[model samples]
Target: MTTHIPAAAKIVADLKARFFPTPTYRQLQLEFDLLLEQRRANLRQGRQQEVRGLLVVAPSGAGKTTLVARVLRQHPSGLRMLTEGEERADIVSMVVPSPATPKGVGLDMLEALGYPLRRDRSAHIIWQLVKTQFAQRQVLFLHLDEAQDFSRHNNHNDRHAVISTLKSLTQSPQWPVGLILSGTPELLDLVNMDAQLARRLKPVEHRPLKTSVDGGMITAALRQYAAAADITLDDALCKPRFVHRLVHAADYCFGILVEMICEAIGEVLLAGEDILSTKSFVTCFSRRSGCPEGLNPFVVEDFLALDVRRLLQPEPGPGNQGRPR
Candidate 1:
């Protein structure tokens, strides 16, 4: 039997698939292509060289992870089918485990490569296996998201060890793989602690959005998404004041802004509404943020005065910690 999917769900999924390639995404994609090409060139020439890596630094909601994933998915040589049941990916993507020790990250990489450890192993041994697996899989890039966790360690030696492991991965003579380290801006301090590592990494930053600069783009995105949802946006919803409030509501993060637009569109679609209005956004904000109409940026007169960022924070209660609303 075929299960029926809700129209709202289908529309939301379609909306998400429409990627808005911001200038920052384009720049990062170009840099990634260049790095991959360089690696390919060196391999073809049989030259033994250390591979350089990218350090992507952005705020929590800037969509760094999504941007990187899209780039990997679009690359021509990013994936390969080795056999009927075996596949090899050019990039092995994983999140850096909390505490961010060498052993933790090494084991995480091994698991992502589909080779989980079967027995207890030392940090040294685990990393050796990780390198071996990476080479065996013919992986070209190792992407570690949330890499800022590396700096959570207060011990000087511990932090240095993590940095050293990353350095060793790129410099491994037998299988030098490029690295993609993406995290918040705090990751810069972690990388800079070791001068050699800092020099070897290319830094790419995703800046927050500004109403004056990004208003047109945001408006276009809203219209595009609304049309995809078969809803017509109200004229007043695209006004400068409403646009500014929308930006404020999203905390000036591009990813969050796109999500807010989609959320508003989803609300309209689900509500059986043909015309999207500011009230739709007001309802969306109230539902997601658990804020009353008075405090919501979409409903408030002076949106800039409201700390919309705080709306995403969880209330103090059982089963509510660390979860928005």
Candidate 2:
């Protein structure tokens, strides 16, 4: 972070300052740290037996993607992704999931696990490759994010095929170490649609934050986000509406909130402000909203279009459908 710079260095720094001020090495943000810890502890303790796995569903603004990205980054098991890499003999996260064609999706997973889908190979070949290569790679987990899109199939057969493949994965040779599926409530319902899939997944559903959670704990998370962006809410800013808005912003899935706050805070700074103002606070709602500069009016429009009640929709499944004990 040296400020002094040579002429050539100055240009590079200026470009970076203007375009990529924030480092791009994606990592878990502060907001979703708590939820990440809870999940990691669950996986580590092998206490996954309580439910088949976990299901994290929230409204549009809930920040589920950020949390998933963090777990992908920090999960000790290795962040498996679909993109091809060289040193990928061990960590294999197959991004072979599409609501369109179940077989194609499965093939994508095969490719991610280091299985070469021999040029012009048959679908069966791909499926077999996925099975064997995954075993060879000894992947410990299969986390399918944005799973709600799985319903994008053309026919009932494809859906069943997708469900069957998922079920088989859970009962794999590796004892199906862990299955973490995340998406909106509709995704949870997709699992429910297939009784067998629902039985196998044992989803871990996420709950919304109460009006107040751990009083100081939730506030502490808010403080961390504020600190990250070099912005702090003043005592005067703690009026009922302001406090409620701040809390609500922080309430969504923590990991996402962190990503969102980073961008939102960037807006506050770019505006040449010393501290975040109420107008700034309301304007910077989400990372998407803070795109191309200030909050995009459309993000607010999409959110406003949907009733906020989706944020607090009761768990839609028999699993933990009742109040938490």
Q: Count residue pairs with overlapping backbones in model 2.
A: 10
lDDT of 1 at 77: 60
TM-score of each: 0.88, 0.62
- In the range 1-325, model 1's lDDT, one tens digit per residue, is 1132377778888897789888888888889889988988998999748999998898888899899878877766645422223556677777888878777777876776667895478888998998888788788888889998889753678789888888999999999989999998889889999999998899876877887888888889888888888889899977889988888888878898888888888777777777888988998898888866656888767667666766654433575333232
Off by over 4 Å in 2: 1-52, 76-91, 94-99, 118-124, 173-177, 214-218, 247-260, 285-325
Error of 2 at 280 (Å): 1.9
Worst ten in a row by lDDT for model 1: 78-87
Tens digit per residue, CA lDDT, model 2, 1-325: 1222243243323322321111111222222333445545765876433224445566554655545555565556455453455433323433326544766676667656556465477656666666666555544456677777776543666667667777776665443434567677777667877887776554333555443552344445445555644567445443444444444455444443444445545545655554645555555553333232112222232222222222334322455232221
User: Which candidate number has the best lDDT?
Assistant: 1
Clashing residue pairs in candidate 2, if any?
A: 31-254, 32-254, 32-255, 52-202, 53-202, 53-204, 54-204, 55-204, 80-93, 99-152
Q: Specify the poorest-scoring 10-residue window by lDDT in model 2.
A: 19-28
Local distance difference test scores for all models: 0.81, 0.50
What TM-score does structure 2 among the candidates reach? 0.62
RMSD of 2: 10.9
